[model samples]
Target: MTQYRNVILLALAQACFLATSMTMVTFAGLAGIAAAPDPKYATLPVTLSIVSTALTTAPMSIIMQRTSRRFGFRLGAAIGVLSALMMTYAVYSGSFILLCVGALMVGPFQSSAQYYRFAAAESVPADKSSRAISFVLIGGLVASFFVPTLWRFFGDLFEGVDYMGAFVFAAVVVACVFIPVAFLRPLEEAFDVGSDNAKEEDARPMGAIVRQPGFIVAVVNAALGYAMMSFVMTATPLAMEICRIGEASPEVIQQHVIAMFLPSLFTGFLIQRFGLFSILLVGHMAFAVAFMTALSGIEVMHFSVALIALGLGWNFCFVGGTTLLTRVHTQAEKGRVQGLNEFLVFSTTGVASFAAGLILNLYGWQTVNQAAFVMLVIASAITLVWGMAGQLRARRGRL
Candidate 1:
């Protein structure tokens, strides 16, 4: 297992694997496909796509246990290809509900893609895990660059043909994920399906493990950070669209997404230096900063920096929380506990994402930012309580 492990190839595969997330950028196409029959369902495509992934992630994990990571990823990518094709068919037929169903099928593929970072970590030593994870994240960052471009270019390509062009473009991105999943050299020490259950006895129930403060803190820290970021970032696009600050210039939105992913470049190293809790604290403060920066109004420059700061803050908290959560469980407990944690964490993000659009449309801007701040505060309070309780327990033990 002393392989040098070509980090570069691993990183590229992850980027390509993650590139499928850009399907959301194809919203215009989905919109056109749905607009004729059901205006209420116009946003359903992007929304349901996430819900689809959420529902399937755990089942996909089980399948991965029996299959090689390579094989599981291949299946996910293949489904992505199918989803893209289905999306094209939906567009051709102007089937709004079919587009949503296609989205549902797309979720498992994304669920499989979620493991790419873990694959990257397993490729290297413990010391390099953070770096490897960050390398994979680079893929996410790079997609932030092209997603909007794909959305816009494809939106323009078909013109009066409607968003079908964009749907077709998304299909191309889904197809791209297939090549990497196909050609990726499976990590040298990643789970071998045959040897996986060697320690099945060590598998603890989710309830018993999540009871640990470390586990609780890690999951909450993660869920809260994501929920808060989603709460705010979800609103920001609409908020800016309302203010007309950068709505006319689409580059502004593209730059905002770039800011979100760009900070990921340094998050792994930062976590290594400052410790996970420190990063968590910094993330809260950054969220606060992002919210405050937006209070002045949605100017392009103001929101641009705010969005980027928000994105970076999210990266630190999320990556830190993930790393810490990994530490709190044994192999036996890993599946159940990790599954539970992600379910809750992503559930929070989904609520926040959904609420962002709904709340912004209803209550206006100030209410949205204020709501995000409140969630951030609540999450931070939970973190502080966990840390303080741990310290008190340690002191009492000495007595």
Candidate 2:
């Protein structure tokens, strides 16, 4: 198959798998269960999925190195189905801890999910890489349609069902992932095993890359954009729940998440129209708009619009940042650099997710948004400074 067609098919299948897993995993929005005795603990299931991916993403990527994309993707799909089943059983049996275990398993599957975008990005021509990443992300846009809507549709699929119907629906979706795998042509990947040179290059003394203006800026833009977004976005559902503004915070989150991915539909087009760096500016601006809207009045309507804007904002910054950063490294450096990059990226998010409860408990939602705003400022500053410096250097060379 041609490279572009490969990306389209893989992205679509990945989106389907995600739509299922994401719907099943996002359970905190159920009004009945959420009003249960311990409401503060309502989001543990979703947290479980995020935390698992953070801890195991590196290992999952490494394993995929030794194996092909098909094996890893299929394995993850299988695990996801089983996890959904286990979760359903956990709910049926009313075992909270067992439900946690099921959520934990969902993480590895998410880590596997990250590969679809990266894999799709790599298979394309260099000029089209950004568009490729955006294409895979567009799958997320489809998730926007399916996740919240499915949450509602399935929630009522069975009477008095909190999230059980959603889980069953998710299992079916995850199981269907294998169908695409049957046709997925294993694209050549540099991260595959026996990649010693790749590892060594990635292992370049941390100080070296840290000193490189380009490397520092790239990593900072990607990691910080991600970290700051998670910090606030992670806190969003909790804030909404605590404030009692919405009975369906999970459903609201699904909408916000959808908004975040929806921009993927247009980001690539914008990148082609404007430059990659220019798109980053738009993303940063969108983030500011989202923050303002989120904090505008603390009402649910404002909050939803703001959160959705934030998601889309993040989608642009992170997608653009990652797309640009890939150009800063060579093929030999792909595995380690990508690995190191992701390690830092996920690590920051790990800290953000873990700290969300603590931060929210200590400070109110407004404070949480304020902290995120400051972090956003720092991230945007780095990109701006780097762009200016690059311009100056180019002019000096011309002179």
lDDT by candidate, in order shown: 0.69, 0.71
The digit string of per-residue lDDT tens for model 1 on 228-287 reads 776666555556556765333345455555665677777767878877777888888888
In model 2, pairs of residues that clash are 260-311
At residue 193, candidate 1 shows an lDDT of 32
Candidate 1 residue 396 C-alpha distance from true site, Å: 7.4
Each prediction's Cα RMSD? 3.7, 3.8
lDDT of candidate 2 over 132-153, digit per residue (tens): 8778777666665656666667
* Least accurate 10 contiguous residues by lDDT in model 2: 28-37
lDDT of 2: 0.71
In candidate 2, stretches whose alpha carbon ends up further than 4 angstroms from where it belongs are 1-9, 28-44, 118-134, 186-204, 245-251, 265-277, 395-399
Candidate with top TM-score is 1
Q: How many residue pairs clash in model 1?
A: 2
